[model samples]
Target chain A: METFILIGITGIGLGALYFLIASGLSLIYGLMGVLNFAHGSFLTVGAFVGFWVASKMGFETSMPEFILAMLVGGLAAGLFALLIEQLLITRLYDRHIDQALVTVGVSLVVGAVLGGWFGNDLRMFPAPLWFLSAIDIGGAKIPADRVVYIATAVLLLVGNWALLKFTRIGLIIRAGVENRNMVNALGINVRRAFSTVFFLGGFAAGVGGVLVSVYSNGVSPLIAATYLIYGFIVVVIGGMGSVPGSFLAAMMIGVIRQFANYYATGLGDFVVVILLAVVLLIRPQGLLGKVRS
Target chain B: MLRWKYSRPLLGLLIALLALAPILGANPLSRPGLQQTMAVAFIWGGLALTYDLLFGFTGLLSFGHALYFATGVYVSCILINHEVVVWWLAALISIAVSALLALLVGAASLRTTGITFAMVTLAFGEAGHVIIQRNFFNLTGGENGIALNADRIPSLFISVANTKFIYWAALAALIFTYAVIWWVTESSAGRVFAALRDNELRVQVLGLNTQRYKLLAFVISAALAALLGAVMLIAAGSAAPRFADAGVTISLLLMVVLGGAVTRWGAVIGGIFYSIATTRMQDLTQQESFKTIPKWIGGPIAEPALVLGLLFIFVVMFAPGGLSGAYYRLRLRAITKKSQ
Candidate 1:
């Protein structure tokens, strides 16, 4: 029972990390209908930026300074997203396949650049101040950092949910997702909205990058290729245009992956895909996804 | 003034030059390397043409094409391992296996269009890759991959060098592939593929089963890809899972896009051009002059991937119609001026 709890907690932490990354993909797909294949690379960029900031600022001994590092990393990632959208994605939005292909190209470019710059070695930032000790629950001990990640993810989810459900921008975004032409005709600047969503989405991916980098104890060049595919799987399983759906799906994938890791050696990557296939068969539009009339 | 009308003579001259290359030239393709590259390129070009049959013409881009290619490659490679020395017979079986797989995958996947289709194809491709990779100890040979001795062809041809035989075989296959594409593109079925591309709903409203047509297109494409894989195995003397990896699929897609996808000969030219240019770029930059800029711009930025990435970006942003499109435009201009 204790072991299960520990496993479940780890799973929750993973799910949270996934949610941060996948939510951005969901929003971009929802509003712009662009798959953003380079989103994982964007997260990677952020992670690397955070590492650079920590190193550059000489925050070697400081744990609390990583938040500042994360912010800087996220800003850089957002800027890169903006540049990609402005230069390439804007031209290919009408052609989704082309959009996918271009983003794939972007992924290769970013990955290569990152590898060239960072030298393929993994680097970690100092942990947050709150994660100094492990917490014991019943007979199970869980890392304080893992709890912090879960809390941060939940907080972000609630904050995003509230923003989407209650804010004017969220309402506009929802409208845009349903029908971009209609939203444009209703006097909303759809392009600006799209740019805004991309920025927010990129910001979320950046945060996920920082969290995952810290969680895994470092960032590696190959991590983008590895986890980007997983993020895509999560988005597909959750439903492309659904935010809450991603949250639910992320948790499921996270838990299932943890279970698979424990049960099946050397089969972590495809567990999500198998689950995705099963989900796709039962509900083609995906779980929490409304059927397209 | 009417000199260009005899284009067939020019084509014949090119073929003659290719035939005489081994004797006259010192390049790799002139001697032992000719067979390997030609066979590989012909097979790959055939696959690209098939991809264009669906994507360039039909507008249905399936990223999971490697699935069918793998199916055929693995089957043929396994048969060869078991001493199935007859190339023609193995090719038929391989084509059949791949065609069936294409039919199944296309049938299910063609139900959805656009992003869903792309995602499903990717799913299938990944599944295929993982399945082959995990069953390493058995048929796949795991990471190390299965190696075979030299491929055995029919005893009809005289005892020539392995490279010369391979060159002739690949050239013949290339001719056959080109003929098939030419016939298919001019056929009634080809017209329907075009219609399906234009508007599937409209075709369905016309009482045509667009899905059936799409499946047919997919199966044909898969067979060609499989045939190409057989040639590759024969040429390389081995089959690795990397043949079915996503990079090859993307590279093929890039070739189609860069060669003007809708044109019949575009894929062939594109494949040859992409292969030659990418392969030769490293050698070209090996000159003292080319190395300095790459070093200065970014240390060792002269890598093929960097060059490829830059080239692809340029093509996407500027040369949307690709090299073949430029050729067509030039041809049109020349013809119009002559008439005037």
Candidate 2:
């Protein structure tokens, strides 16, 4: 039971990171219909940005320093996203295969760039004071870092919900998702909306990247390929355009992975892939997807 | 109808020229290294063309085609090592088995389109790669790879003296593969595959079974890929686990896309271009002084695998129709001006 809970905690920690990364993927797909094969590469960029910032700040335990680094990393990732959107992705809009192919190219370039810049080593920042102290709940001991990560995830989720539900731009973004053509027909600059959505989406991925790096204790260039596959699986399984669906599906995936980690070691990637395949076979449109067409 | 200008006669002539390249360069380009590169490129060209049949003609982007290709190498290696049959017959059986596997995979995965299809194929490919790398090590020869007896096939020319049979065999296979593809692409079924790519739903609405057509393309592509794999192993005298990995799928896709996917001859050209650039670039960057260059820039940038990936990006960005598309554009402009 202790091992189960501990594993579950770790799974949730991973799921939280996945939820953040895939949420961006879902939003981008919803608004733009892009597969964003380069999404994981963007995450790598963000993590590296955070790593560089942490190195420069030379702070060991300050929450403010971490927050600043995250913001900077997010900004950098957002700028990169804008460049892709303007220069490459925009041209391929509404062309499904072209979008897939172009982004794959973007992924290769970005991955190569990261591999070149960082070599193959992992990079990490020390946990803050709050996350450094573990707390025992019942008979199970949960790491302080997991708690901090999960709580922050929940806060971000709530904040995103509030922003989407209440803000004018949020309503416009939602409107755009429902009918991009109609929104453009209404003389609303759909391109600007796409830009904003992409920025937010990339920002979410950037935050996820920092969280993953901290939890894993480092970032590797290969992580982009490894985690990108998982993120796409989650996005597809959760329903391409559904934000809430991604969250729910992420939790299920996380829980299952936790159980799998308990029963089998060194099989986490395989288990997740199998689960995704099963889900795809059973529900082609995904769990929350509304239409079969 | 299109001029039908690129006929089988032209293709035969091209193959004849290529087959005689070593003889033509009897003194120089016919050297072992050049001959080996040409041989490898021809076999790879066969693989890339088959890949194009699926992606370019049928409009199905598969990330697991390497599964069949790799399966062919491993199975043929096992058969040859066990003395089950002659090396030639082993290749046929390997292709048959790989086709059956592809059929099973295609039946389940081809039901969906777009990202789902890509993801499913990727899952299967990774699974195949991992299994062969780990569980099937006995037959696979694992990381050490499997080697074959040096004298496997009958040699016809002096070119076959030292690893020279590879060139003749690969060239023959290349010609055979291209002729088969050319014939298929001209057939009524090939037209339907092309149609399916343009509009599957419309085909279904027209009382034609798009599923069957997709399966046919998938199987044929897999079989051709298997044939290429067989030839590659025989050429290298060994088969390694990486032969069946996701990277091969990426490289093949890059080849097709880089060469101008929809263009038939472009696939072959793309294969050669990709093969030469990657190998030559690696050779250029091996110097100690060159090591100072960023790994992404000049050093490993020439790694065929990495270069292919970058080309995949560049092709999509700059040349949607691929290299063939660029040629077509230039030709059209020249023709229009002449007519004016």
Which candidate number maximizes DockQ? 1
Off by over 4 Å in 1: A57-62, A119-149, A214-217, A267-271, B1-20, B23-28, B82-91, B149-161, B284-296, B333-340
For residue A180, what is the lDDT in candidate 2? 78
Can you write out model 2's per-residue Cα lDDT over B291-317, one digit (the tens) per residue?
887665763464444566666877787
Model 2: residues >4 Å from true position, as ranges? A58-63, A123-135, A215-217, B1-10, B23-25, B78-90, B136-161, B287-314, B334-340
Q: Using lDDT, give the best candidate's number.
A: 2
**Best-fitting candidate, scored by TM-score:** 2
Tens-digit lDDT track of model 1 for B1-340: 3235767688789777766666675766665655556666666677788788888888887878887777777878777677764666777899898988888777667766777677777777776777677764487776656775444545433234656766666666667777787788789988999998888889999998888888888888888878777766666667787877766777788788777788867887777777767667667767887655644345325445565666677777777777777777788888899889
Q: Against the hidden reference, what TM-scores do the models get?
A: 0.88, 0.89
- Quote the lDDT for A74 in model 1: 82
Error of 2 at A147 (Å): 3.5
Fraction of native A-B contacts kept, per candidate: 0.17, 0.30
Global local distance difference test of model 1: 0.75
